[model samples]
Target chain A: MRAQSEAHAPSRMVSETDELCQKIRRRKPSIYSELLRENILEVLKCSFPRFGTALAPGKLDEIASHFLSRHGAKRPQFHHIATEIVEFAHRGHELSKPLICLLEYEWILLSTEIDSARIQAPQLSGNTNWDTSKISLNPTAEIVATPFDITLVDIPVELDGTEQNYVYAVYRTVKHTVVTRSLSYVDYCLIDLIRREGEVAFNALVSAPPVQLTTDAIRQWVIEQSQNGLVICGTEC
Target chain B: MKENALGIGLRSELLEALCIQPAREDIDFLEIAPENWMGIGGRKRDQLDILADKYPLIAHGLSLSIADTVPLNVGFIRDVCSFLNDYGISIYSDHLSMCRDSSGYLYDLLPVPRRKENIEYLTGRICQVQDIVGRQLVLENISYYHRYEDQMPEAEFLAAIAEQSGCGLLLDINNVYVNSRNHLEDAVAMVRCLPSNAIVYYHVAGHLELEDGSLLDTHGTKVGEEVVRLGHEVWGWHGPRPLLLERDNQVPSLDELIREVGDVQKSIAAGDRYACSI
Candidate 1:
């Protein structure tokens, strides 16, 4: 039982030893702390460049240190750490809504670029039969609504926290290039519906609440989005 | 890849440069941290496919955390093996230190206690990893800063693990030099202590010296002259192995790195000639 416990929960076996080493590490300041701290900071800086710039002096470092002290051991991958940094900022930092939104925007861009999930759109030899086809958004596509125009902010000061009422779609194209597009509320609602339902029929989409569009408008919009590689036309209705 | 071959750690920064010159003669092979490539897609995946076709790739994992007392991360090891199999790479190396504890991954290699008693524990883990990888798991000696109580020399610990577990060793010459200087040990003697049969490859990289004289394994700059001299001694002792140039940060242009690779090759040849004459 002891051996089994040691094998399964190795930390339990050496909790005292680990504690001792942690104390020694703190006193001696090994390369581990510096290297780990640097990795976290580098990821945060790269993921949200504007956020790094906006934070006051040493705030970014504090955040990185906090993250390292808290979640450093938890995340081994760079993207995973980046995600935790964004999450920590939102939950703990009391960051401005604009700043949080900006971080989310930047994260979406970084996340979709490397997202492994692929969506295979059904091959349409003829034109996509809009009336009978099921429509779905690309798996890599993400939609976010922000209170402020975080995209328009050029500098830290430009983000005045005023409401800009922005809705955006960030998705990776077939070529794997991440593209961000500002979306109208109606388009946002349609994408949200497709995202929530997984697959939506053409009539169902047109008849959906918050999407009171004519058949022609809906068809045109779907075609436009398809051209943009944001929407995929699935099986025959 | 041939013995005495030169390779470079393939960083994403070098992808554009590497893609342009797939047939470059200076780089005999490419080493990658499989952790970076696994479960990733997009243009990066496409780039990896192109490069894999061009040069033979070896897997050097980052998050194995082999020395952790907890159960082995079998899932991650399998994924790494899968990546290696996909690329037709059989040589896989990771640090002989813990990266993850019970809480989670530290994202940095922490020192494994070098006491004699650890040999059995470490041996078991190493053997388990080798079994999972379906190949000899080559363990690199990490540059640790501090010493622990009742610690044996790192060389002894490493040699024991390699011999007992039948694992291979990646002799990071820079790390050896750093640890030697920091801990007041003879670097060459440490290399001599390691079992020759277990030493499979060599890692030559740059390091930074702190104000207090302790060396940091930064891998930021060019391989230092002292480390190159040590490499000469290492190759002379172990004969020429597949030596990889690791530059994790402040990476220069490909041309500059290629030139550096050429320099190391020349040094290794000179060392071999010296050994033959002796």
Candidate 2:
């Protein structure tokens, strides 16, 4: 009797998940991942009282684990789960609000922990003090505020050969007063240096007595900054 | 009204092109969205300043929401009026729909209920807008889906609004085609009922048809045959109004859109001469 009850539980969960998927799909025909569908339904069930009655508890976690394992995601990241919940809520899903709110709180906690870890981690470069005042935010930078863990919500659990999630992000732009293809901070420093001590060639940036630098390193940095759209190649009039 | 003239929407995207194009020669009057440049400072304002100096421009907006029960957004009205005064933009227009509610804005041009109450409310709002702007404000009929049950027929509602507001009507022929297809109404009969004397302009654009046979007013493609015919008919009755070709998304090359506008002008001219004889 116990064995039989245990076996029947999963089928019931699958049925409940399928119903929720259909409801979401009816409104927005775009979302098509089985894992994302199950995760969203789980979030809905936990956050919404009506959904809880319809779907069994712990079923959502089971489905999420299955999805995470299949998609090569760390079980803890939960970025996919968070992202899905936030996106659905953004689209005006009634159940998405509470879930998104919970997810955001969770992300704030995670970001705090990550920042502490970063402080302990070995420095990437010897010069830790970098000027960022010259860097301006891109005009199109968009910041989406949601209640849930948007990143976890969107992580794909099951990948069929044919499906993908539509990831939305805040668009931002940085403007440079002078043109040089360099990382925003580096270009900012270079411009400041030039203002302070007239024009300098590629070698001057490396040979500046206060900061030890290499010609190859400066060139690479310039290339990287240019690629990032932080630096333009001409002086502003 | 000219045979080959095509007016491009003066969006920031085409500011560079506008700067380089020999002013007073390359294109006809540029149509600007008054809301974008109104009360805005810096680069966008500077760009408009240069363009307005050279080209004859008009203001087009999306947020009038003329039929809402809520009082008009006074700030928006003042800003638009200031813009018109600064730019000397005489032809100011918005859609004949309500976009906001008491709660908040919908960010889409939603359809207004075509009821007696709505008509009265909209007419009063239009009068207020015109009085504030100090110019004749033209309202364009919008494409709609899921119309209210208590609404009057579209033609009767539009004709009533025109008569009551004493404002010019911007007859959007493509929207009529979309609504006609969606609701299975006679587009020609609807066109005939419009107050011909009040029509200030005509608009033509593309629409997308969904799998369920419902039409979406996408404005992202070429104008259809039905819209062209409706445009010709409107020109036949109202004489030649400034016919603008509106393509917001999926816009083809300027050459292609200009060609389409050229065909429309030819048809309008032919229809105008024919109607004059009668």
Candidate 3:
């Protein structure tokens, strides 16, 4: 009889647990409490692990609450949550550049992934022109120009204190793998020039600047970037 | 879907080990969470293409949030349906619990309140999803830490949902043991209460034991003896449905996972033989 009672206790306990939880749920604002906060925090930690590791104990929970208050019941977007975490770490922790770059790089991977799915790749047909000046960057290509090398974001070694301007381009390949290719300072500026001005004449892009890089060098860079599929060639007009 | 044939959850980390010592002949299929693959582009996607080409892929989604109050993300489901069609994936499984409420996704499965209203809600949603996909979806019993104020038993709720929705069951036996340990319910009784024929397959995985002696379904370790026994009992009762070994985190080497798969096959063989003798 005693064994039977002990054996039966678990079902009763389980029933009790359910009853208590149900009771708590019926009274108010729906199941909005520690669980919801933790849910948001867990998703962030799993998706953007570097920040989770960098954050001090209890800090994740704190940031999670901040996000929950803002996000309410809507599923927080990966990039949105990641951006918030980067800023949160910036205010709460040590120097901010590395963590920010880390989040940016990681979030770009996710963005490029989603971005690739939406790309319809309007086919160039009937009088297709492969002009460099007529081209545009692929939908998935994104450039990050930062003072600190974003590659060091994952590496634990200390920064050398020599923060040079660096350009990191995140792009999706034919095989769909996400990769980061670093570019020289000149290349970064030249790429930015085209993107900002939108389909400038070949000669216009190569010249007309304070940095005033040689036309030949700029032409060579354009050929190289164009070959690499970094920029779409302009249409035949 | 193969009767009594073993399956393993495909993990990227185990790819090298698999190449070195390919999975055994008894390992009939591979299971993957479609959410991880949808919108993914790169080496990982390439690897999946290769895997799908090589194996019979079954999609088990983690983010469907089928029971959530928000209207279904029809676009997301459409994306998944396309992926399944592209890969020739025949079955798609998701958890019985909700991953969201009116608010956004919780990122983990939450208990569904076991009430008639909620049952009707799941029935309507499941039927709606089936209509969109043109096939019945399988809902796995999730290992939950908290039981919502359910007016009914888990088994009864699941049975009703399946019967009304025309869905199947992916019985995760490890979840049975984990919930039993955590909540003090009888694992075998829970399994017995379910309509056995509805069990299309079974999920056996490892769990973490907390310091307080309760078990958590972490799927980060080796499947224990209790779970193995429970799986065997399932095979005996169901007369050899499919069994899948799932190791989500702390994945072991390929050899170790295969061995676990092999162990389950042997246990089921033994259990089925025993049942026949009786």
Instruction: Rank candidates, DockQ, best first.
Output: 1, 3, 2
Per-residue lDDT tens digits for candidate 1, residues B1-278, read 57788899999899998998747977788999888888888889888999999998988988888887767877878888888888899899999988766556667777777766667777777777777778889999998875667777888888888878888999999999998899898999999889988988899888888898888889898877778788888878888888899998899888888788777668765853211110
lDDT of 1 at A5: 19
TM-score (second chain) of model 2: 0.90
User: RMSD in angstroms, all models?
Assistant: 4.1, 16.6, 8.7
Runs of candidate 3 exceeding 4 Å displacement:
A1-58, A65-70, A73-102, A109-139, A147-167, A172-186, A193-215, A226-237, B16-26, B272-278
A5-83: candidate 1 lDDT, tens digit per residue:
1233333336644763454334337566776677778888888898788777998888877765554345455457677
What docking tier does model 2 reach? Answer: incorrect
C-alpha TM-scores of all predictions: 0.89, 0.56, 0.76
Best by TM-score: 1
TM-score of chain A considered alone, across all candidate predictions: 0.81, 0.22, 0.61
True lDDT of residue B220, candidate 1 = 90
| Candidate 2 per-residue C-alpha lDDT over B1-278 given as tens digits, one digit per residue, 9 for 90 to 100 | 35335566655456766676667444577787664555444344556778888888868887676655555776778878887888888889888875544443323455666766555556666877887888888988888764555568888888998888788888888899999998999888898888888887778777787898877777777776656777777767667777787877766655565666666667656643211110
Candidate number of the best DockQ: 1
Error of 1 at B223 (Å): 1.4
Which model is ahead, 1 or 3, in terms of TM-score? 1
Q: What DockQ does candidate 2 have relative to the true complex?
A: 0.03
Q: Which pairs of residues have clashing backbones in candidate 1?
A: A10-B69, A10-B70, A73-B104, A73-B105
